[model samples]
Target: MNRLFDIFRNKYFLSTAAFAVWMLFFDKNDMLSQYEYRTEVHKLQQEKDFYEIETAKVKKDLNELNTNLNTAEKFAREKYFMKKDNEDVFVIIREDAKD
Candidate 1:
């Protein structure tokens, strides 16, 4: 017990402990700020991954539309309301939205 008290009272050990506590709890860039930075980095990484997957899907669809004439025609007709010269197109809209 006396040895432990002596160690605690030593100037070097006391100063080191005080410095560590100050840096961890009271410094400008402390533990809480570090945790927040890590959380933001993880969120941004997830967003990047999601966007990359969406971009790949879009690229695949573009490739299919470019290579397949039937697919291209179907996409154009559905997305842009296009039609052949002799065809009359009628659009039907639903009144209620589905969840």
Candidate 2:
């Protein structure tokens, strides 16, 4: 009984147990790293969702352009500042009132 208790309470055993606890809970590759990795994964998922929505919108616009000449011309004029020949275009710039 005394030998068993001595083995259980020995300095080497205690130090090894403490080291294991430290490595499992406080080391560089532990719970904190897992939490950080989860956060990064969530951020990437959100970005992917946002890009998917934007891609859907672009695809819808592209499909519309294929079948709609008026929409295509409007998109080209608004986005690319295109104008017909012999047509005059005026641009109005708004200025902030507060200095």
Candidate number of the best TM-score: 1
Q: What is the Cα root-mean-square deviation between model 1 and the actual structure?
A: 3.4
In candidate 1, what residue range of length 10 has the lowest lDDT sum?
90-99
lDDT per residue as tens, model 2, 1-99: 999999989999999999988887999888778889999999999999999999999999999999999999999888778899998767777998996
Tens digit of lDDT per residue, candidate 1, span 12-53? Answer: 999999999999999998999899999999999999999999
The stretch of ten residues in a row with the least summed lDDT in candidate 2 is 87-96
Compared with the true structure, the alpha-carbon lDDT of candidate 1 equals: 0.96
Native-referenced Cα lDDT, model 2: 0.92
TM-score of 1: 0.70
TM-scores, each model vs. reference: 0.70, 0.67
